[model samples]
Target: MAMAVQGSRHSDFFVEGEVYCDTCRAGFVTNVTTAIQGARVRLECRHYMSASGSVERSAEGTTDATGHYRMELVEVDNRGAELVCAVALLSSPVPECHEMEVGRDRAPVTLVQDVGLATMVRRANPLGFLQTMLARYADTDTRYVDTKMRHL
Candidate 1:
């Protein structure tokens, strides 16, 4: 679920990433992981206009069948100020996997053009949901007695 920032001919920037369900509540993707469709993602940018002033801009996008989402940021004026941008999870359509994973809910993106990079593409971290019931552990009585009771 890494995010990449790309530049378009129209001068607008595009941010892309993926949303998934942490089936086993693991931080990273696993063999049993599932993609989350219809999940809402947001790209937010904040810039300091002056010592006492600041502004924020945001764009929203939804995950496709493949759990991929891309958002275009338009009307963005750096104004000599560094724009701090990040992609975050907004909402998930899956009722059982709607809770946001702490520390992994947002990914920072570099949008500055003066980094001396040959390409506009930049990679980032991931955002995903954890299964509400830990279905994989439903049958296990080792650590989750309550959950195992429900399954029994």
Candidate 2:
């Protein structure tokens, strides 16, 4: 099933990154990597707090093999933020698992290479959101960004 991307294509601005095991700092490498699959990878961009309490969220998603996943950030004015990108392995195909949080400064970023942890989260899309925005911004007729494309 094709998901409706506001633009003709999803871009590099779409964030995503890698995942690693705490004990083994390698890619979730090996055949028995079941524990790392289906993990929740989240990235939150908190600006300097709005007058209201609406702290902005940059993106969020889950991880697949190659130990990778992606998330899209939806914002108007691009001001960087303190980002918290995290991964949590859930339910016992393994056993008691806790969440791990990796914080870093984020601009219009696409990838977060491996930090010290076993896994990492990066901007999933290779083209990024702005590329899609351009399609909308350059619209000769209709606005495309918010337009919903059919899947079937």
Candidate 3:
């Protein structure tokens, strides 16, 4: 006789992501990203048929020393509908990197039960901020005038 193993009925799902400071001002997060500590992030969810038509639920968390954050979400029951979820950057504790970068502020994730995974874990893309310092140009003493003569 073969015995069947049953999975736990109650489980928790999680959303994980990282926040970084774009030190190079490259407008994107690269391998050499500097992780920001104490950065605030938020997770929002919305149901399609809500009366107010706004976000149904929201949760917030802060980044650790490594600029990583994880937020726990209630296990979803995908009986016949879907829920839309998104993770967004709230604020950065670093004064210089506090401004949110456009197009890199939020990331969307889907939470469904029929994915065949024992545990649900979603990862959002790295969000970043632009550099605060302005560009500098060097002054040169050498100067040239435009010559009127043209060679044929």
lDDT of 2 by residue, 48-144 (tens): 4555535465445666764566666544232443333232222211122232322211224423333333333243321101112223235454434
Tens digits of lDDT, candidate 1, 1-152: 12334333434566788899998777888888899999998877677444643447778889999998888766445441376778889999998888887788999887765567665454556688988665656567756867564776
Q: Where does model 2 exceed 4 Å of error?
A: 1-12, 24-35, 49-54, 80-152
- Model 3 clashing-pair count: 0
Relative to the true structure, candidate 1 reaches a TM of 0.75
Worst 10 residues of 3 by lDDT: 143-152
lDDT of 3 by residue, 82-113 (tens): 56778998988888777677688889876776
Q: Which model is ahead, 1 or 2, in terms of lDDT?
A: 1
lDDT ranking, best first: 1, 3, 2
Report how far residue 124 has shifted in candidate 1, in Å.
3.8
Superposed by TM-score, candidate 3 places the C-alpha of residue 55 at a distance from the truth, in angstroms, of 1.4
Best by lDDT: 1
